[model samples]
Target: MATLSEIETWLHDRLPALLAEYEVPGAAVGVSFGGEVIDHAAGVLSKATGVEATADSVFQIGSITKVWTTTLVMQLVDEGKVELDAPLRDYLTEFVLADDAAAAEITVRQLLSHTSGFEGDIFNETGKGDDAVEKYLATLAEVTQLFPPGEMFSYNNAAFTVLGRLIEVLRDKPFDACLREYLFTPLGLKHAATDPYEAILHRAAVGHIRPTPEAEPVPAPVWALNRSMAAAGAMLAMQPRDLLAFAQLHLDSGKAADGTQVLSAASVEAMQEPQVKVPALGLMGDSWGLGWELFDWAGTKVIGHDGGTIGQGAFLRVVPEHGLAVTLLTNGGDLIDLYRTVVGHVVKELAGLELPALPTPPAAPVQVEVDRFLGTYSCEVADVTIRQDEDGKVWLDQTPKGIFAELGAKPEPVELVGRDEQSLIALKPENGFHSPHVFLGDDGTGRALYIHSGRAMRRAPA
Candidate 1:
């Protein structure tokens, strides 16, 4: 195994060059091992101002916030205020969905495990009020139930916001206040920021985006997404070290630095237990626990989650068996490559495991059953249309909607190559990685019922 000193020296010399090579404006990485934390940073926090990134720079952790929200729910569990298997309506009676029957049957476990089966990417603008999160619950009134509740695994951002609202109703505080009082304060986090106001107090990184695939990245038009979706990872910023501190608590079975029992050991263990198998889609983990992504890195159990908001992306991985964790936070530019380069190295040399290699197109394109995938799949955030042309080249075209459009997201179209009968790899790279698409279930007309790229989009009716 590589010594901690050896790892630190290599990262200090290597991070800056990797940022330049990957075209990321700024990034920070924190690693925790043997009860100590080490962090490194490189590049400017924003290309426009050129403020150099530092160890204390705060970057948005995105949907990694889901785990935090989950922790808060588990605290309620530890307090005997919530039951994992109990129907959500039993606690938050105001919780309603378009499918009232399915809504009544949804359990707290399904939400935490992301099997709520409703359209999950609903990021509505609720303004910046303390009631922003509460206002979000009403937006789900017309949300489409993609499947029966707890039927299967589907990534659901909206569900976490629901969980956040549940926390508020039980704790009698806004989501942000609950976070401060419950998790941040007890964990002794110094640089974590829940919104733009707090983030601006620190050296904050602005996300960068390439206007076009071949263009150099520029500063994003907005600093963060709306406050309403905060629990769903719309806007939570912190230095990677602070993030690792939170992870260390989980590694220590939910005991905080001051020895507060923030979560019961049983809840921590349940959070890491596999609850459902994910679809064959390569975009996410092999399966999910309560809130953590479960990965089998060559039979070595690794738990973590990745989050992306606007142009910023965050990756977290914890090896509980090894008592180790690593986080990489970035403001745009080939995030997956940088993550694999940094986290992959730590896991390999330190824990002696290999991250699963990302999918790549075959050298020779193979024929696929394109007819079955030719249709439109609709979701709240975006619509994906798959079609094939005369040369038999298949393509997936995505058009962003709602909050995504406000943040300057544009229509993206990529050619698809056959990866298997049910999945395909994008022939073109976005942000330096090919996106994998998989068709799941049947829509009764021999068409795919859902098109999955992390979040599942149901097939649109003609």
Candidate 2:
């Protein structure tokens, strides 16, 4: 393992090149091991303002906040105020879905595991107030149930929103206040905030977006997600060190730095226990736990989560056996690429673990009959269509659904080059990144099964 000085030198030298390479506006990184923490920041907070980024500058940590919310729920569990297996309705009596039966049957476990089988991405704008979460839950009555409760595993933002509401109801305060009291304050995370109003009080980074393939990224108009989605990872912003402090609680067996039991060790273990097999198709992690993505990195068990909102992205990973964790919080740019370089280097240097390789295409592209996949496969968030033109080249076209469609999101058309009977990667020029697309099989009823980023989308009926 490299010495601390070596790691610090490497970061200082390498991060600027990465920020430029990825077109990222700015980023902050934190690494913790052996009672020492290394936090660093680079690039400008925004290209427009030219504000230099700092280790103390806050950026939305996105869905990484879900684990924090999960920790809050687990605290309630430690106090016997919530049950993992209990129906969500037991605590959130106001919760109802388009499918009344599903509303009655969905358990807190299912929600935590992303197995609730409900159309999860309900980004309906609930007004900013203490009652925002309550109003959001009421809006669920309009959302269609994607499947019966607990029948399949699909990422569900709405489920976490409900979990956020659960915290508010049980704690008798707003979700933001509850987060501060139950987790942030006890851990002394002064730089962390859960809403835009609070975030404005700090040196928070502005989100950015690349308008086109060749244009420079500009500042995003909307800085935060709809207030209703805050619990599902919309609102929380923090510096990298503050994020590591939160991760430290998990690495320390759920005990705070002051030796207070913030979460029972049993509850912590349960959070790491595998709950559902994620559909990464050989990329990312193999499964999902309560609020964590479980990875088998070089035979070591690593638990972590990645979050994205607007154009910002954040990542948190923990190697508990080594008492090591690494985080990346970025406002924009090629985040996945930045993560692979930074996180990969740190883990290899400190913990002797190599990060997963990015997906690559085979030297010779394979060809297959394209009619088999010539249909639409969809989930709540998006839909993808596979088709073959008269020239006989297969293409995959993907677009947003539900809330995303309502917001007028655009579709990306990728040229699909087959890798096998079951898999392919979007064929781009050598300079472009190749993302894998796999056909999982048939989902019965004569519909083709497809997996993208660990979420299953089946053929949609005409």
Candidate 3:
């Protein structure tokens, strides 16, 4: 591990230029290694306000909040109050789905691992009340199930909302209160908060969205996601430092800095162990753990998660064996590029580890037989259609659903190239990064495309 002075020196020398190269408005980073920590922040928090960023400036850590949610669930497991294998209906009696049989079989483990296989993206506002998650659960009664329970890996935000409700029921308190009492307060995270109302009490960064590649990013139209989706990725806010401190607990076997046991050592290990294989979606992790994404970088195990919300992006990566964790929180601009540059440097410098290289496209592209994947594939918040043109060029038409569609959204057609017999990559013409659109083989049930962050978009009935 690099010394604190060395890490600070590297950040001062390297970060600003990289941020400028990526056009990132602002970013904060935290590195924890060998029981030492260093934090760095750069650029303005918002282009409009011109507020300088600081290490203490809280950015919505987006889906990075999933690990925290899962930590609370594991704490309940430690108390013998919750069982990972038990059906979720065992806890939330009001839980129902369009597919009743599958709903009855979904387990707590599946929810944590994102294998619940239901329509994942439901962003209905349930109002910011104690009953928010309850109302969210009620709305799922009409949502469709994309896969049978535990059948395959599909990123599901709705699953976490369900888990959020379970937490409310099990703790007999609101989700935010339970988070404060069980995780944030116990860990002494002074600035950590679960909703915008609480986050505004701290130095919070506003999200920004760019209209085009050359356009300047402006404040995002939406301030925060619906409270109903809080557990999934709605409202958690914290600085990179506190986020790293939380990761340190996992590295310390669930023991806080003061030697307080927050989660059992066994539960912590289970949370990092590989639970199910994840489809390739340009993510670093090859598999999903209880809540963490498990990555194998040159045969060394790394665990962490990435989060995005309203143009804000956050990444947390932990090298448990090396006692190292690094986080990057940014408000806008080519986030994936910034993450690759910043986080790629941190791992290589501090831990003697190289992050995964971006996947290269095929040397010779092959046209796909569009008919096989031609049907409409639907999920909770989006539908994707595979189409072929007169020249036999295959592509995918992705259309947002629900609230997004109501706001004048339109389908985006991304060109596809065959990576293999069963897999295709949606090539973003500008960057050429390969986002895998793999076809999970039909097994009598139906054919499906694992798109939208590896969520299964099953073909509609013929």
Question: Highest lDDT, which number?
Answer: 1
Q: In candidate 3, which residue ranges exceed 4 Å CA deviation?
A: 366-368, 406-412, 429-432, 443-453
Model 2 C-alpha RMSD vs. true structure (Å) is 2.2
Residue 7, model 2, lDDT: 84
Model 2: residues >4 Å from true position, as ranges?
Answer: 366-369, 379-381, 401-409, 429-433, 440-445, 449-452
Q: For every model shown, what is its TM-score relative to the native structure?
A: 0.98, 0.94, 0.95
**What is candidate 3's CA lDDT for residue 25?**
87
List the RMSD of every prediction in angstroms.
1.2, 2.2, 2.0
Superposition-based RMSD of candidate 1 using all C-alpha atoms, in angstroms: 1.2
Worst 10 residues of 3 by lDDT: 443-452
Local accuracy of candidate 3 as per-residue lDDT tens digits, 212-253: 545776778776788899888898999887898899999999
Measured on C-alpha atoms, candidate 1 has an lDDT of 0.90
Q: Pick the candidate with the highest TM-score.
A: 1
For model 3, state the Cα shift of residue 109 in Å.
Answer: 0.9
Candidates in descending TM-score order: 1, 3, 2
